[model samples]
Target: MPYKAGHPCFESGCAKIIPHGQKYCDEHKKMHPEEIRNSSTRGYSSRWRRESKIFLKAHPLCAICEKNGRYTKATVVDHIKPHRGDQELFWDRDNWQALCKPCHDRKTWTEDKCPVYHY
Candidate 1:
């Protein structure tokens, strides 16, 4: 379906109409880079995965949910603080939390001011 004439592009200051089912216009889409990176390249390497598996095994329930008296199974090993690409912080097990998908997504959205799109 074609976009309505007045629908603005998602990119800031661009007045172009967004195509149906797309967040951005053709121009903005081309300008934007890939939103997410592969786990291996984004520092979630094989080692990280292995460690995360071990951590998750030990912490099978979501920490936040557990604190709230809920028992949700954990699927993500998240850093308590923003790592900001810092190697030390990224690998710090003490600063980690076991989170279910919803809990992790909510926390990340709060921290980053953006939604976690799993494309």
Candidate 2:
């Protein structure tokens, strides 16, 4: 017989009932816990790191340091708006700034304890 939309079970011999419009019974199509969980937990892969590295290499001097007359090498990217929950600011290149090691360290320390990044 053809599959029925309103049928409770796929077939009389099936032990478990199937949902309307489904071809297979529950036991036949049920997904494992690991399969379902792993699919959702997938994260960003290596491509993102490669792009960021390329950007840093092309512009190697700290923007802040360069502007302030210090020529420290920029090794880290700083997000004007942090990537905690503000998703809109994630890839905003205009909001990115390069910082030297000591300056970056001081900025992070100030951010952890103070209200703003000081020059």
The candidate that achieves the highest lDDT relative to the unseen native structure: 1
Estimate the lDDT of model 1: 0.80
Q: lDDT (0-100) at residue 44 of candidate 2?
A: 25
Q: Per-residue error at 72 for model 1, in Å?
A: 1.1
- lDDT per residue for candidate 2 within 1-119, as digits (tens), equals 88655545444476565557565555644432222233223322365456557768878999878988889888877776544324456566776777777877787677633223222
All models: lDDT?
A: 0.80, 0.60
Question: What TM-score would candidate 2 get against the native?
Answer: 0.50
Cα-based lDDT at residue 10, candidate 1? 80
Please name the candidate that would achieve the greatest TM-score relative to the true structure: 1
* lDDT of each residue in 1-119, candidate 1, tens digit only: 86465578888898887655566777767554344344566588889989999999999999999999999999999999866566788898999999999999999888855433332
lDDT of 2 at 35: 22
RMSD to truth, every model: 5.9, 17.1
